[model samples]
Target: MRGHRPALRTPRVRTRGAAIAAFVALAPLIPSAAAAVGAQEITVKLPYDCALPPGPQRVAVRVAATFPDRVAAGEAIRPTGVTTTVELPAGAVSDLTALKATTVVPETGLALDVAQRGAKAQALWRGTGPARPVAVPAEGSLTLRTTGDAPAVTAVVNGDLTLTATDLGVDLALGTADGAPATPASLSLTCTLAKDADGHGLLATVPVGPSATPAPSGSPSPSDSAAPGSGRPTAPASPTAPGTPKGPTTPATPTERAKGRTGHAPKVGDARAGSSADRPPAPPCVKKNPTDKSLNAYITGYANVRKLSGASLIPVSCVQIEQGDPEIAFPPDGSIHLLQKSDAYLDYQGRKQTPPFKSTFLTFGFAPTTATMVLEQAGPMTVASDVLLVFPDNIAETYVRAPLVLRVLDVEVNGTRLDVGPSCRTQTPLSSPEPDPATYPGPHLVMLGKGQLINGTDATGYVLTSGGPLTGEVTIPAFTGCGAGGEDLDRLLTASISGPGNYVKQIQGQTCAVGVEVPTEGQCTEDRQPYVVPKPER
Candidate 1:
């Protein structure tokens, strides 16, 4: 939940809903990485507060770089294979979703503080990556893992050259799935490292002392011993060290080049999620009761039409379930019913998850109409697992009745956009039609989901402890509210999209650990997910 925006607010007046987000929530840990020099491997995970338009959100960062455990004086203190992973919680991503800029490829700028004896300087750790745009995932935080080379330090005095982390800036280049500029422009987030009382900012320290092997005649003299980009040198460098171009014959391959104190310009680097191995163990997880009790959840329900070729994904609006609530039940002959079938407040307005149903839904099995379907949670749904304790088998079954409002956004009946306004959506919340009043239960539409305990747990059928797939079948009811000014679009869509045997498979992501303390470390992660979809019931 660190970067999750649990709520997706609807657009008031004909807002063009684009696929605003696409992001990969990758693992932060990179397996065993070694530097060519066989230096000590150092990794640090730090917390920072990043300033965005929606305010400041906590950002977690893991930095991995290789440096000599100890270095002799006059020797270069260069850190190799510098990789920094920047993470933003799903809540923070929700803010960007609201802004309508979803896909992002970021360029990062960082500076690590350097100090040795009395000399103080800084090392540039600019990170770049390829333009693989990362989307705002339906669930989980957005992660950017990148590696780059930085300016190294040269030990001058006979002391420790301390490397400390400092604040950083990240500019996100918003792009679409096709790698084009999104509706909105780019966004910039400023993250300042949280001050650590224990000097946790210190990354590594290299001891500067006598070297068993002395510097060669052309080694950097004590004159210019300043770290690259340090602005001031402790001493002047040897003529050959500074690329001063001594004589023509000696111009052969200079070992070191002149590094400007102004620092290197930020460039786009390969930022894809690379392969990993030898992943180190994460810190122990600790959970505490939290003040916030609502867990953020997303239901990416894939709805199938009996006539369509494949299942169409219908992602629902953000829903919340109380924390610590036992989402289990015991039932044999009955189920929990809502409003006794006569609720007056049943309407089809709670619609926010709006994306044009992709995979061509052909009108009359031939014509293609630009159609948009928005799935809405009409009422508070229940996710309860029936624990049948009397039988030899636990026979755990989880049932969910999501009161839904399915809205059709647009219809291209010979260019009828002029006849109906944006407010003219599929009128009624989904409702099953019954001819007789005696059998008419209520005016609400619902999708039914059932889960059976399989992996051997108290509540294995329905994913409550974490997220997994919950599959069911939905019989889409007829449509109504979409006609205006003689354009009978609702009747046309009802005839095409409604029917039984429609499979419903919803993928749920991990919760923000509502009952756990804020910033739940390992207990709340970005990638814990359900592996398979439950078999759709008849």
Candidate 2:
């Protein structure tokens, strides 16, 4: 409604024919004042005005046209067709309901009623042109009526006029020039009524020109500021505090980096895999607090990563940066296998909730000595098998191979060596992992503080595995691929040995000796035998 074009005057051609013929031809154009009043052509709009509600609603057609000067009641003026339309504001609710209109010209005045419900509301009319469909867009105007009891509604011809009737069954009393009899106009309209779309009576009423009253000298002019009483002392400006940033410092320009504002870049971070100083402090690896801004940002970051990754697996990675006192131990092979509660939950478009914490433990391995992790269960989707890591240099990267998962084997602040996929079943899928620039794009790693792994597209939430369960789900950034229920979370554990014993003894917190197998060519098939770590004596 804010951007709608001004109401322009278009010529309405006159024609004479039966009611059926007139309806057929006039259906394209609005009926003229001559056709309705039996006088010279007069201009008016049918259903002269309407009441539109704040939300979506629909209304019907009001035929309008012009006539010669003034005409008495019972005189019929015939011409053209009837036009239909609606009024509304921008970003406001639209009338999506179905709408239809019917009109009748009684001996004295014209009457029209429009019905719109659901999506069937027809807000505009079309003329029957053989070649092309006539485009008669909806017209809406604004009218400033006097507020309070017995509100006076006048069409502001000077500015665009929009009449809104607040209530139904409102009385419309019309008077012609001096001593002319008043027209008793009564209109009852039903549909959705917005405060702005409300109409007082007719739609095609001629606007009354501005009154010729003289201006009062005491009235304030538009350009003049309000006058204040003299002798009032102006208040002194407050003194600035020491060591504080200057007030109203110029806003940061696009060319300037945001100073004092710090956080991890979207997806990239230090390439350092595990080190107290190099890695960002773990997120306390705690459950997300709903109102926590950092938590929200973290969740959003995770969601963004998931969107880019296009994987349905849950995300699990060590928190690298910390706002206050950030520190993490680097286990042998640079992997720290710590438990993590998810930050939020995600689901397929309103379908089913995927399991949560669907992934647990990651074993960091190097290409020379480590590189093989065990897979206890393959999980649900093959695509869910992947892990993203931020290197010491602040570069975010990913590794994917189903059934051969990674685990946090150890943590050492210095000289830490992380191991991955030692007992991992290769032949699953293997390649010296390389970051897809398009997916893992980022600024220089040395400059970034923290980063996030792109988790899969499942509902994400955090729940304490060791401590009391703190539960909360992250909000999906976009509405797509999310609804009430869907893939909630993903969890997995890769053992370091063969048989269920390797998997069973570990999760129970028992001391179990497990064997590790070295993967060949970054791919481990069943042919590889693992070194067994004997189970501890009970």
Candidate 3:
């Protein structure tokens, strides 16, 4: 956001040589005599009716003087200068443009010069030559025009203006430019606003209130009521009155003049008020997976194995698996569960572990017991789950056990299953002498037989490891999904699964294949049945 600071311009004053000198020499004597000439306060009305946009808008302002009155000294009163201070509501104004002042009082030899600071302007006047004295025109007016960016200019009555956000204060001082006060018997300052080319007169033609009644032509002037010791008259309790205490006193300092004065500005019906309570509560946040009925979803992988006994392990063929019935649930407490049914076959060399050989059930669940889930909003969801290789009771010889168990950890699931922990390594082949169970977790099945696989968590197996279930933790990448009833729900989904206890191949000593190895990498797609859960109520 850029700020617009008022540009400083040097004051332009035009004065004839002898007249300025004479006026300065008599400046001291003029104040006392001017005080007795009667105080003349005029109502300045500024009618504003402009159609503005909701935000900041620019409008042109025009201030003009009209109808000067005759003074008691048998000479017509001439206003050489007019100084006005306008304060806009806080935060309601931005910048001003095209600010200028000009005189309309015909050839009593008056010229105009303008100076302005933030919200304040002074129009100075001087005689054209030493021979001409400043004189006010009975019919002409002095006009000041400037463009300002304000919220809305409601109205300016007396010296107070109203805006939609706050009030604006305006102060007017008229007399000689050199600080000499010349009292006028009667005068009228007409302030008009030109909005969108339509002129709206702000000055009130009719008498305002009791305090603002018109003074008769021959009536004693308002300045006649001066206090005993002070040479200035008491200002009336009207909006047009200056904000300072009334009495003869020094001119206000620059700091004092810049301060905003408080006054009442009438409110208009253009602004509407609203409260936040009126808004309806928002729907819960949730996401759902897409459904694909085809059971062709498969994950495939290939890995190179090395036997620690100095033999190069077999180069495994690519393995493909079928996946089905995928469902993810997110509860209010921020826990998530992912369940899917999958099946794959194990083949090494000439022997094949056919269907019903090992039942495979992939269950990924995430429950954060200590730290918070990073996938709560829209990031990758990482959770802990175990990779379980279960061999069901089947036609294969009673049951075969290997010498070591395999554990997969640090599984990351984004859009795809990324790294699957460190590769399983082995020192002895399946044919080698079995290591003690205490020394090594007797080999857990790293591959599952085809027909033994079930669709979901119903697959049966035995515990083969000591620490816990094969399920560790796995992360699922963030995905877009539909909420309950097809509402748009976006969230990072994650889960942790307690590993299915390792599958015990045999109780006594049945023999399966020795030195068998499985690939460590694969990709698959699943015809997953998607399910959606409604967001829980607060």
Candidate 4:
């Protein structure tokens, strides 16, 4: 009886009242006026402070993220794009920026944009390659920063490093703030905090047309030498120190010191003792500096001089001389073609071999003629003895013993001779068609051809520039003790430097393709004039 007392009379609800109740319940789901007040995503913080290193040192930056709000179940945190700005020091190049980053992140992707020197800045996405380049405004002392609050975002940026150009005396930084700003995320700003090395600005790297044919092997060369294979200019400081003297020294600026040399002669203190007395009298001429624009233009002229090829002792071709006092012609082809009316002495014959000379694998391929003694070698030969032969003033086949390694500079035939040392390699050209570009993508960048000799004895010739073309030839006469026919097995000098991007042709017979497998030559057969292709390790 007590429970039914309150609801004795039931009242009917009006339709208008029901409608109003529904409107009130759905109001929260609709956009509220205050909804815009709260932050929709995490905030990005930039480092406001910056520090510059004393001298030239390279600096790099990386930006990563940490989790706070969860975007999805499996994905917790990731990287947003990183933006770096560099400020050049006063009097230094303004607003120059470079970047170094990798696309390695979890659950999220990132992009990197750099602005330097008021030039067009580059944007590289983590997963993708370089994007369209953009231009940035000039800047003053400021901190460069990055933010990643895209629509599909979740976490906040953990931290970021400031990048400063070590090579330049500039500083870089990021901005740090406690609260967030609701501005557009486009980081299109520039800064000036570092200065490029004085006088040591980057030089231009242009590819010349083609290589000229090498001069004939064993022939007397005129006084003038030829240009390098890449047609890059040579550095004229004297062939080497003791051999000759340096040209007039103009005031050298600090920038010149930082540029360094391209395997040029060492500085005064670092010069080596004269290795061999038999070393030909130092060349009378000086090498032109490779960095000189005028000299480089002159050298590139040889690209169309002549084409070298074929198997003949005396190459029938010759390239015209461009400059120098006593104009001379050189063997346009790489091979030494000695065309004689009658047979002549082929091997060292009158010359005495040197010591450490236990046994040498003499590799020779001679086509005996009525007057020509043409013996061709795959590369240079390594003899174990130290025996020297002297041409007699009277009439004696005299001999002498000297240094172990012989730097065959000039080749003498009668009284005239040709330059055949390291310098000569550049002067000579390939008889074969410029190496197939398909085999080596950037043909001009191969610094070492098949028969380049480096550092006197080491067969490992180095690639001159990081990505420059091959310069000289590469040959290895001695591989430990594995003799011709693979006998007397010694240390193995594998072809690590010979690979794709370099030259390695495919021929049927035992051709000397960079990294090809071939049967060993018979005992007594050696690779004469062998060029050593240098690898990064050895």
Best by lDDT: 1
Q: Which stretches in model 4 have alpha-carbon errors above 4 Å? A: 1-247, 250-492, 495-538
lDDT per residue for candidate 1 within 1-538, as digits (tens), equals: 1123321111110001111110001111223233323467777787888765356777888888887755544455567788888887887677566656657665565656565433343334656544355677766788887665554445433544566777666655555555556544444455678864134466765555533245677665433232322233233222333322222211111011101101011122232111111111111122223234444433344555665433454433234454333333435665431111111111112323333342223234323334555565555555544444433233434444455666665555322342433454434454433233353345433333333332222333343434445665656776665567666666666776776666556655433333433322222322311111111111
Give RMSD (Å) of candidate 3 vs. truth: 38.6
- Name the lDDT of candidate 1: 0.44
lDDT string, candidate 4, 1-538, tens digits: 0112222111111110011111110011112222111111212222221222232323232233322221211122222343323322421112122111111011112222211111111111211111221222243322223332321111111111111121111111111132211111111111122243221111111111112234487643211211211222322212232332222122111122213322221123322122111111111111122111110000000011001111111110101111112112235553222111111111222232211000000011111011111112212221111111111111111111111111222232222332222321111112222244463221122122121222222212211111112232222122222224433322221221111221212100111111112211110011111111111100
Residues forming the 10-long window of minimal summed lDDT in candidate 3 = 529-538
lDDT of 3 by residue, 377-496 (tens): 111111111222232322110112222212222222311232332331122222222233453343233332211222232222311100001111111222232123443222222122
Candidate 2 Cα outliers beyond 4 Å, as residue runs: 1-248, 253-323, 332-538
**How well does candidate 4 score on lDDT at residue 391?**
17
- TM-score, candidate 3, is 0.14
Give, for candidate 2, the lowest lDDT window spanning 10 residues. Answer: 9-18
Model 2 has an lDDT value of 0.19
